[model samples]
Target: MKKNIFKIFAALFFIAVIVSCRKEDPLNVDFSKLNIDNPVANTPLDTWLTTTFLNEYNIDVIYRYNRFYHGDDRDVAAVKVDKVQPQMQTVLEGFLLPYRKVAGVTFIKKYAPKQFVLFGSGSYNPDNSYTLATAAAGRNITIYDLNSFDLSDPNTIVNKLRTIHHEFTHILNQIVPMPVDFQLITKSTYLATWTTKSDESAQADGYVTPYASSQPGEDFAETTTSLLVYGQAWYDDRANGSTAAGKIALKAKEASVEQYFTVNLGIDFRALQREIQEVVRNTYNYQQASFPYWLGQNLYKSLIVNAAGDPIYSAFPLSTPFSLVNNNMKTAIAALPYGLTYNFMKLNFTSSTAMDIEINFNQGTRSFISRYAYTMDLDQATGQTKFTIAAVGGNDASWVGNANLLRPAVQPMLDYLSNNTFVADWLPTGVDAVNYNKYGGFYVLGTPANNFYGLLGQ
Candidate 1:
């Protein structure tokens, strides 16, 4: 009986210890007094952003100041409310539309950053360098200096578009690494203080820009952005202006960049550049109707005709027009009168009222062709165009008599071109609406009372 009582006591003690160690429910406390604000109401800008960016590409844009989106110590401010729409519109037209048209919407949808953060002020560094734009982790882009944006000004618009392209290129590189050969092109020229270098010096060293010399990755991005932003002519001019060795290296880099887009992304870089340029012109409301525009669209030529409306010494066939090919004049030699063969002709515009004209002539079985250069000038006030022989070389003397025979006929056409009142229709045909090679029309010189000479652009 005593043993049984001890067992019951031990069991009771174990139960007590288990109950003490177990968690116990305590008194409930009221926490309703804690203050918490509701979410801010969506603004019109937010609605627009939702429709433009988020709805289209699932990308978010933040124009309002948000501390979380910026670096802790960076000097930046929120984009001005008024500049936001215009800036965003410019970005869409200048940057995004080009990629969409060239690379396809799906490509951008997949590769574009998920978010864009805009700032009114540039993120200025202690070293006097300013950050224009940057991509972060391939997920976000931050564009700076929106407050000073002027879409009406082509230069400012181009510069801002360039920054966007530069950052976008970085994002693209992050997705698919640039070729290792690109990095090796100017590997030794990479510098920590690239800001100190001048653009000419950097270009001479095979770098597209001073910032491009900071690193190989930046170099690739800079090269691509420069090509896209400045267009092909500008890029070619810079490359050709560089030293011979530098030109070769820069061209190699360009080829690599182009190959990266073509082989890897299936994109034609030139077509892309052309598309972007068109968008830029349309977006800026550029005046495409002017004398300069007409001049660029048409190929000008002078024709010599007799009283019976017959050619005396036409450089090209009566029907054939001279056209610009690779920046040089070209025409067909399929039809020639008097056993005359087509050679070459060039027109270099020195200014609004002056041009340097060069023409070459060839005869059957002749060892050499005759070449002559002439200075063509226009008196803007009087609207009179005059041509004076500048330099005569090659076998040109042999053809001087034939040329002189047609001088009387050619003078009238020259007078018509010089006349400011002369009315001529310029019709441009081709992809760009200004490709003189494809369908350059003729200019009707003189009235029916006088012999008509049709001067065609070849």
Candidate 2:
């Protein structure tokens, strides 16, 4: 009985050993039957992006909406199909190309972010603040708010380019860290909640912007980006306007940034700035043939006469029935008696120094237009703006009577024109239909109490 039990136990142990040593057959599956979806298809935009970004610089542009591109926690929308190209074109022209030209193609290829991800709407925060663009690990960049991009609008163009410059600055700093002294300059001013601070307040505290006051890294990025994007004039203006300590701090920061680029990157910071400024100027050339807001709309002229019934200076015409003719040009068409419709006054910018002001009249019998050409001079030394009538009627003798009637009204314009130095002081307040407010006309520069004419659009 003992021998039989030993043999049975030995057989059980042998069976267990065989089972453990035995190998299982590999699982067989057919990849042919498996369904696979290609997320990124070869479309025209894809080919263009591949050619423009990927092929050139090994950078990938992901315009198609993917939640994974944005973090899972962030709720952002995809960029509209149509807005993608214009916005990208503006960015390439205004931001990247400038850097490529100044910093060199090799420098950008080496330092530029490897991937750019686009979104249509801004990334909204719990505090109601929206993010325009951001970069991660110095490799991926995400730009938001493509839906409202307008290539023609200077403000929009500047703003979007500003974001790109700001983020790119971060990427640059990642490669070569900012000077340690930069943080010490505004060490006490750094705040986590920078949104509460206004730009003016931040400037007073030795920061370029409120966001710059958040941290030293952000401060460096803001200063560099602002200098490059807004140009030296804008930087100087801001620095000049700041408080004494703020000015010192700004200059110190500026010196540090300039040194970093020069020493580390072998780049002339000012030359880079000029290159960027030229690109921006070409993109949004303010000198293009476009009318100022005050010109194309109906203006109410107020005439002021002395007690002796002599016209001292007539304010702009009081509710003139004239309508702008050739909206693109400075000619106005007014309805007159005897079925006569004529350009009341055509203001022409003939040359840099000359402006031709033409006045016309029907007079019930015959109609004639008189041209009063003026040669303007701006006194750069005294900062005084002046304009004077160099010639009257432009050799036309037909409407001297109409020119006489229009002289009083046009004189204030000439006087206002004489103070052309004030043109720089005019700020854009807002827009009303096709007309813009606070650019020109009477309401801008100073109060109506100072000037006789008010540019009101009806």
lDDT of 2 by residue, 216-285 (tens): 9999999998887775445655777799999999999999998999888988776677667666655565
Error of 1 at 320 (Å): 10
lDDT of 1 at 80: 79
By summed lDDT, the worst window of 10 consecutive residues in model 2 runs over 298-307
Model 2 residue pairs with clashes: 301-316, 301-317, 301-318, 302-316, 385-418, 442-455
Question: lDDT by residue for model 1 over 112-192, one digit each (tens)?
Answer: 889989899999888998888889898889999898998677777778888988998889888888989898988888998
Q: Rate residue 243 of model 1 by lDDT.
A: 83
| Leading candidate by lDDT | 2
TM-score of structure candidate 2: 0.57
The C-alpha stretches of model 2 lying farther than 4 A from their native spots are 1-41, 286-458
TM-score of each: 0.69, 0.57
